[model samples]
Target: MRYDGSNELHARQARAKLEKLIKDKKIFDLTEKKPQRSIQANKYLHVCLSYFGCQIGETMEYVKRNYYKILCNPDTFIREREDKYLGRVKYLRSSSELDSSEFSLTVDRFRNWCSSNAGVYIPSPDEERLIQLMELEIERNKEFI
Candidate 1:
């Protein structure tokens, strides 16, 4: 879920809750470190996603192109939240003030980039819906710009 909240307190509360979930290993399992055996990894790959530097499709491309690399060190494939918003948008403390009006445009651009240069056209049809999700995120952060 997006971490946008009404204020610092809300944000902190949300962060705490999310972090707690992480700490409790409810959101993601630590033992599932091996990408192949991990249901989360496969589910993550099977779904569309957008985070930081890599788009869902691009990530899939990276995995396709460098499966061995990812299998060798899964950390190399991990995407951080901060990397996604660094220069692209301003930091808004609350979700209410955010605007992602241009999210679709951004997604279109990223998709074009992915299709033309990233690799073979997203190999999996099941992934297109996941890529479309970038629109929501774009809308979520529209005001940040």
Candidate 2:
């Protein structure tokens, strides 16, 4: 159940319900559910990564892991796991977890970093040139899709 936290009456009603549940020994969990990243933004990210990969002579996965995530957006994707044989394992948080704005920020940081660090001039997602490039790539590489 959801109620507007800002509205006093709604908040009181939700609090009373939660209190009743607690008194009755009911178990529940709560979390905020934000909208996931946009499909268009995801497509732009892949296009940017693919172009950067071509420029740097590496695959998109390599570029995304080494350059984009590590260099541009450091310390944003840390995760941990426990294994029976290997003990504790630390890994990256998946990019899919980021909401639309966070993902866009990461992409922008990657482009800016590429320009300054690697001398690769990646266009911003909204640029007309980038759109053209995306369309051109899709038309040429139909098999990859």
Candidate 3:
């Protein structure tokens, strides 16, 4: 059974059920949930991505789809075929599902991949000047959004 902890009442009910199950000696594994990436992390990631995309004369969407989504995290893509058309399709798992550490690793991989393969050195958020310039450039372009 899948347990959702978003709802207070449901979470309490699920905990009670789990306690009873434990008492009944049913084997189970329980793990604590990790925090997801913060808003600042997300913003920094996008800023770097948009900057790199602009440098390469590509749209942010194009860079995100090809470079970050496909390359850095290929495992998240699910392949399926349509029964009626028999055409293959792919669905990407949302990055929002990733925990803070997982998201940070993914971002690091993207940065490394960009530098090694694309020869584009994306500045870190710590490089405040470059980051601000990139943000301004993206704002001017409008397509970076």
List clash counts for every candidate, in order: 7, 1, 0
Query: What is the C-alpha local distance difference test score of each model?
Result: 0.40, 0.79, 0.79
For 36-129, candidate 3 gives per-residue lDDT tens digits of 6789998998887788788788888777888888887686544455655756766776677788877777788889988898998877768889
Q: Report the C-alpha lDDT of model 2 over 1-145, residue by residue, as the tens digit.
A: 7787889998899899989999999998767767787788888788888777776677778888888887788767666789899999978777998987788788888989989999987877669776677558645654444
Best by TM-score: 2
Q: Any runs in candidate 3 off by more than 4 Å, and if so which? A: 1-33, 76-89, 143-145
Mind giving the per-residue lDDT tens digits that candidate 1 earns over 1-145? Answer: 4444557876898778768998887854322111123443334333323332243324533433343123322333233345554744322232112133232232334344456765523323246574456445534544431
TM-score of 3: 0.66
Q: Whose TM-score is higher: candidate 2's or candidate 3's?
A: 2
Ranking by TM-score: 2, 3, 1
Q: What local lDDT does model 1 show for residue 133?
A: 65
TM-score of each: 0.22, 0.72, 0.66
Worst 10 residues of 2 by lDDT: 136-145
